[model samples]
Target: MKINSMYPPGASGGIRAYASATVDGCLGIRGIKVVEGGRDGLFV
Candidate 1:
């Protein structure tokens, strides 16, 4: 899988950022969320 883009949120709301990625160059995924996690700190 490869990341297409990662954009930070405009405001803080637990979510750290937004992301997009491709898998195996044959599939596409969009609007993947990245957020805060307990203990782990960051969630993706």
Candidate 2:
């Protein structure tokens, strides 16, 4: 799996960034957001 990540302008706090992933040269997934969690840590 391949992943890309970024922090958009004005993004802050819990929801702070965005990402995308590609699998086996497929068109793959996009616009996956990143958020901060209390205990479970970050999730896709």
Candidate 3:
């Protein structure tokens, strides 16, 4: 299964919470990867 989670580059807690949830459902998985992307707009 492939899971793609997208967040607003700097949405602090969003990424953290998503990661925790993914790990919680892992059952003897061979491998997993967490990829993050930056937002496509101004930082301000």
Top model number, lDDT: 1
Worst lDDT run of 10 residues, candidate 3, spans: 13-22
What residue pairs clash in candidate 1, if any at all? none
What's model 1's overall lDDT? Answer: 0.90
Cα-based RMSD of the predictions, in order? 1.3, 2.2, 9.0
**Model 3 pairs whose backbones collide:** none
Write one digit per residue (lDDT tens) for candidate 3, span 1-44.
43444334355532322321244566434323343345643221
Better of 2 and 3 by lDDT: 2
Positional deviation of residue 41's Cα in model 1 after best superposition, in angstroms: 1.1
TM-scores for all candidates: the values are 0.81, 0.62, 0.22
Clashes of 2: 0
Residue-level lDDT tens digits of model 1 in 10-39: 897888899999999999999888988868
- Ranking the candidates on TM-score from highest down gives 1, 2, 3
Superposition error at 2 for model 1 (Å)? 1.2
Model 2 per-residue lDDT tens digits across residues 1-44:
78854656364668767878888878788888877787998876
Give the poorly placed runs of model 2, Cα more than 4 Å off.
none
Higher-lDDT candidate among 1 and 3?
1
User: In model 3, what lDDT does residue 10 have?
Assistant: 54
